[model samples]
Target chain A: MFWQVFLFRVALVAALVIPTPFFLTQAHADENLWGYVYGTDTLPAGANEIYLWTTSRNQKGKGNYRAWDTQLEFEHGFTDRFQASLYLNGRSHQISGGALAEDPDRRLHRGLEFDGFNVEFKYNVLSVYKDLFGLSLYIEPEYQRIDKISGERVNGFGLESKLILQKNFFDDQLALAYNLTLEPEWKKFQATGERERELELEHTVGVSYRFLPHWFAGVEGRYHAVYPEFKKRESDAYFLGPNIHYAAERWWFTFTFLPQVSGNPRIAGRNSNGRQLSENERYEYRFKIAFNF
Target chain B: MGLLSNFDQLTCALSLSSVRRIYQAGDLADDLVKCRLVVLRIKIGFPRQGVIMRTAQWIWLPAACLPVAAISIPAYAATYLTVEQAQQTIFPGEKLAPANIMLTNEQAREIERRSDANVRRKDIKLWKVANGGYFIVDEVVGKHEFITYAVGLNADGTVKQIEIMTYRESYGYEVRNADWRAQLAGKNAAAPLKLNKDIKNISGATLSCRHIADGVKRILATYEIALK
Candidate 1:
């Protein structure tokens, strides 16, 4: 009886802590200036979810501002442990108080296919053991066509692979996680001599507390190392953010702020002429709302 | 005094003492005798009414009388009822026994009819994503559809599982974000799945999070109702 009780408790802790590593790449549009992805852990089979959020980010020195991004997401379980989902996001950036002054017409940018969308498939590879640990794998790739300031159209596909690790301590009230993200992009520039490919690797570590029933707060710091093969000089950006979330019976909401603490300087301009890039990173504020059926 | 008279008096005293001891040890003790005498006293004074007479007349009889009659009636009653009637009314079948659990064909058809009726009644617009799964949009926002899905959670609301029943959006990037959903495994369902909360908001996919979280809440609500 004693061993059984101990095992049960251990299993509960595993269920809460493990299986987090598989969901690390998909970010809420509220906190990120970029679009949204749909790969996350499978909702319990037969369960479903919808999430929406918007956010804006600014450079640390208040230049190179990104506009608010809107996101809508839906996910469902087809079995007891496996789940699938579809997600869509639209983003518009404004050069508010930034060096790119002539970029006021964000709509023209949209015509270049600034918006991106993708589909995701996920499976709970393992969750039935002791429930102490869970495993899942997801794959997602997206494409968007955008017009640069030089009037050149760029079509790019972003491929991302993420590993999420969830660990629990102190009777399942506290959870710690490490997430690794790999993003590779293929870009084709129209009528431009610039190389049309770029890649970024992002790593983040986070800890969350189940402070109240269906409520949680956590802090995550991410380091994004951009390796632009087109541009020889590599750059890395760092962000620190605090998040607040509320999940109700049929809906959920989230808010967060991420300040770009550090970044590398842009060595040279490829498509744009006579442009001076800022050395400082950007800041972001985000909010999201979601409902389930 | 004469010798014979004295002997007779001694014998009478001895006999009385033996009787007293026997009464104390046996069922005819003082408490029983008192209780019996009280009952007799009450019975003697009661009027000859039918109700009182019924008890007065029955109490003196043997205590085994009613039990014997009760036992005999059940035996006779069991023999009289038909097998079907006995099976239905007399006893619940044991584990080894077989019983009917079949539904009529009409009833089965009725269930299917109701399911189709529900599908026709709701405003659901379905779309197939390029990667996988069909999206059912019950609500429309601008040109995009606001899709909803369910997230099954445990008692603590940690994500036990997830299901996407409806959606209409880009499938590639959104579908790739599927792994990101695991971040919600330990989240509190009563709270919001915000970036500022315990979850890590994805860089490009914040908008998708909102729709997914909303769908999760709806699913949890259904689970709650079912539990009750």
Candidate 2:
């Protein structure tokens, strides 16, 4: 157990620092400029990068709640216009005595576990400099062995696709981005032997300013609408947040804090402060770092 | 043996500057001759035997082959132009007197303020043309590389010509197109000089275009405030 923790830490640190020779080049554009919003830039041909992200979901209106979701990603550019990535995701949550867990039989959950794997691809269709604006199409398929929220054993599959758009102004110091995403997921719960399907419609808008050299400050807003079993609307949630980003020659970090501003959830019998606590957390904090070679 | 002796010096030349300088200034015959020279030296150093020369057969051979391999990589990333060549190409039959000037922080700040572009360096490499214009060598951060380019300004502060001096890019080669660069000509400080407005944009080259456009704008602003 100690070695597992130690080796994991060491491997992450080594990944962040070992590729010093990549110092000759700058971070590729495909490196996420925002925490949640997608940028339309693709990596140069033959370039590769590694990304690690940790997001903390906090508060659920009742009881103590905190969950950490971590994802380690490896991305590569096959061509100047196309890029792909693989992600390994893990989650640890402590939700005690709350409706945060959808199943009453699993109200309290704890412990960390490997949860999911995902593959993503991006194709650039237009360049912000060469064309009127930038555009890219993205597709990702994810497989989950454990539930992210309830910490229950399950088999889940999801396909998420997005259309990313970007436009820069003020000498490219200020950038605006929008992403439209559609995701559908299927899950079979081991505890109840129940099957569920969900379709989520999401959109994000972001604007960032390069406040200082290698540093950026921005705000992003996200809206999510979900339908269970592809039926009527089951929930509505919106989040708004601020993010700060700093990028060096070989590495970059982006931190964002998003709080649920409004939502209507069916779980927990009621909504808290007009915010959905059953389906989403009261606030989420994410820190992402990426290294390129 | 000669190749082994020159081996130490050969690896040092692998530095990007020296390698690119050699590759840019060399022709096919010249570059291949260097490659073959290393190979021939190693060939001579190998000892001939009667039956099977297996003792030192592959040993030390790879070390000698290193330089030969390095020399064969064509200069695809970085390309350059000498300052003299740039001056002559921009202004033929005109004498350019070296009039390099250093910008004070205040002047640089003012240029940045007027152009709305950040100033990374304050030292400007400038020359005064015998004709009524000026030539300035400048560099801007491309999408991933530092693009060194030269700009000529007419006496009235309008751009005369722009020449890329040193270009290194993994992608976004469209910025090097003559037509893309030519659009910046005849523009002055007052021009919008913004991407997709006064100057057109090329896909996959947005940052390159923005930085180069901002660079030209900064130079024009410099001319308006300091040089004028």
Candidate 3:
């Protein structure tokens, strides 16, 4: 089943990439301006960039769990309307002393592990510079290996897509952006020979004000929903935060912090008392630094 | 190997200021031929290797097209309108004399405080019409750039016409539209010329509209107190 899913994802990516090179014969240029929380714009044709980012998520639970994810990405613009990127991802975890900390089996070891890889493509359908609201489409495929602390392994594959929209007002001093994302994943447990499938939908909205020449400040809100077997709605979450961005001629940086306001954990029956409980995260923070060449 | 050696020499020659100066002086025909020969030699040296040759071709192709692209872009004249042209358009063939008005620091501050906009220049030019009116040229900040415009007021202090002299912003060129400028006509110092209230804003040119409106208000006040 995992092999079938992986093959299907690979085929889909191939279908999209096959016809791209035929139209990439010309080179053009455009601005690469962006907002902090949501991807609101595309790079110019023939532009190339490298990005490095890190995210930390803290969860308040039995053992005070914390997870860190890091990614390095190479992005290129094939034309004025299309962009492609590849990401190398990794993760690390740490647990503090608490209810589940005494059990070595329940606590995660503190170390970095190779997570997986993802390929992303984006196409701009409408441009704001041409007196219209901006619209873009995004598609991505991801593969991951769940590394074991002692000797447990799980693997997963996923496909995600998004519709992004943006608009500018007050002579480009203020910008508003929105994104809707859908993802489906298949996970296989090697030891149990069991497989599980899940679907997720997420919505994000952001507003930014260009306060200075190269500085922008904004706020973002996010809503996440999960479905088991693509049928029953199992859980949901909401997060809101502030973000800041700084852009220069050759490079840019952005930082954001989000705190989960409400949500229920999917595996509520696994709690100590076997009661349905909230699984909302305490906070999450991310920083990205990118360079254009 | 000989081609590789010539490629190195070609790069060194292109990097020299003397070669650039010679090109600027209109004597680069011979040097251009040498450069072309070096490029041809490099291409011929790797003809059998398709991948390497294609990579080299892509690198030089855009470089060769740069001059054409640069020359193809259209150039516009300077954006400013001279005092004579501005007076002629505002008064239509009427002889107008230029008078320089220097504002006191207190008066400049008073104008800024009343209009809620920055007053960058204290010295202003007022064109006195022989018949009866004042033509004033002023500038205001519009989204990191200055927008220069001319304001004409009748001797009775009512606005006659407003014409944009130079607009420096890439976007919000809609502020230069005549319909938008006509909104301020007939407004006087006693009338409120606030943006979004008295002067309807253009859809995508809000900042420019607001700044220009505020500037018109300030100019009206200046005329009322100093020149009227």
Over B117-191, each residue of candidate 1 has an lDDT whose tens digit, in order, gives: 111112223222232222222221100233334343444434544434344332213422557766666554354
Model 2, A218-239: lDDT tens per residue? 9999998889999998888999
Per-residue accuracy of model 2 over B33-58 as CA lDDT, tens digit each: 46444322222221222111111111
- Per-residue CA lDDT of model 3 for B1-228, tens digit only, reads 254533433232233334445555665645865544432322222112222221111112212222333343233223756767777777897878888799889888888777655677889878888878999999876443467899888878888888888875434567778898888889987777765568886644555777788788888878766776
C-alpha lDDT score of every prediction, in listed order: 0.42, 0.74, 0.62
Residue-by-residue lDDT tens digits, candidate 1, A127-206? 31113544556656776554223233566688777665555443333556666777777877755645556676778766
Error of 3 at B67 (Å): 37
Q: Model 1 residue B119 lDDT? A: 17
Candidate 2 overall lDDT versus native? 0.74
When only chain A is evaluated, what TM-score does every model earn? 0.70, 0.91, 0.79
Against the true structure, candidate 2 reaches a TM-score of 0.67
- Judging by TM-score against the true structure, name the best candidate: 2
For candidate 1, the chain B TM-score comes to 0.31
What DockQ do the predictions score, one after another? 0.01, 0.04, 0.03
Model 1 lDDT, full chain set = 0.42
